[model samples]
Target: MITPMAIERTFVRTRKLATLLAGATLAASTTLVAGAAPASAAGPCGSSYSRVGVYAISRGDGTRTGTLEVYYSSSARKNCALTYGYGAYANTRSWKRVTISRADGSQEDTDANYYTYYAGPVYVSAPGACIDVAGTVPDWVTRELNNVHCG
Candidate 1:
């Protein structure tokens, strides 16, 4: 037999799990989506986001890599989250990118501040660094590249 308190706990847990699953699904779906404009190809996500810049790093092989940075600011302007990414490109010349999705497909909560980004690796890593790897882009430094973008 289940008591009311136990049932309530179960309901809460179930709701949390459902929310988690929904977030995961949204993120998975939006990953393949790309925005019209590209943010930064260089610099790590920081307080003063570059907003516009993408540095390139090439590997000897036919491959490339990049890093991206974005920012999120709370209402008080105190809490902030810096999101970054590192991915890889099979073709060095062409890029495999990740962009912000539209609100309809946003991964995170609409009210919560966040940034969407994608990156790739061009070379092997060396200690704290990866070959042909650029840093992140600062959110503060970007213009709307696409009508449907994540910020």
Candidate 2:
């Protein structure tokens, strides 16, 4: 036989369980969402250039094995980009490239092939205008650090 108090207690318990289930569902959904950008590559850019941006290359396996870096030199008033590939390959051809473009449509690109390790410190003069920079490695994909302001 159900009394008024018993009915009230059962209702309260059911409401608490429903609230817990909703919180759990929300937490699970949050974990399923993906991030928009990749993590930073590694280490300092170098002595001459200060790193401005870092982008990860998209390999087919969804690994963060390759990276692209953008740098700026206050003294020289130039911006540079570089590419890096982790793990040396034996008898495997690898290359890295960087491109910089000016607002007036002038552009500069530098590329290097490495049988051993790193690629280049490709540069362009970034003065008084916005510049776009991009980098690439062979057989993979390229990443861009879009229009950045430099004075």
Candidate 3:
């Protein structure tokens, strides 16, 4: 499953057309290549750039848990985020009740949580508006799924 991190923050910045070149789309699609070229490859998103990152969080409430991270800009006009949930780990519970809180008041609360045991980072770029997350998806996302399916 895909996790979404919700952070809260405001910023303003120019939308630079940055390129993200990858090695092989089919091979390393889910894998994040380190120090990749600016326009090496496209991400698992519609936009040319990947902003939001998702991760799964282990909860103690029998119910599944997860987190989100919304990235902010300098001018308070641009923002992005990342998310992940428990389904990615195969928990079996819905992860919609989850939310990620950022330093800003902006929020990130979801009405659905299909992730329950599997989790990973879902990259997405926006039009500089939804950069306020509600919580954090934890660092384990990178540590756990870093090389699981990545080639």
lDDT of 2 at 92: 46
lDDT of 1 at 29: 72
Candidate scoring better on TM-score of 2 and 3: 2
- Tens digits of per-residue lDDT for model 3, 44-113: 3223334434544445453434544333333333344344443443345443332332233344333233
How accurate locally, in lDDT, is each candidate?
0.35, 0.67, 0.35
Candidate 2 residues lying further than 4 Å off, grouped into runs, are: 1-48, 87-93, 149-151
Q: Rank the candidates by lDDT, best first.
A: 2, 3, 1
lDDT of 2 at 99: 71
**Model 1: lDDT of residue 96:** 33
Residue 145 miss distance in model 1 (angstroms): 35
Cα lDDT of model 1 by residue, 1-151, tens digit = 9899999999999999999999999887777555433464432333333333343333345232433323332222211122232343222322233233332333221111223443321111122211121232332222222221122
Candidate 1 weakest lDDT stretch, 10 residues = 122-131
Candidate 2: minimum summed lDDT over ten consecutive residues — where?
A: 34-43
Top-lDDT candidate index: 2
Candidate 1 — which residues are off by over 4 angstroms?
35-151
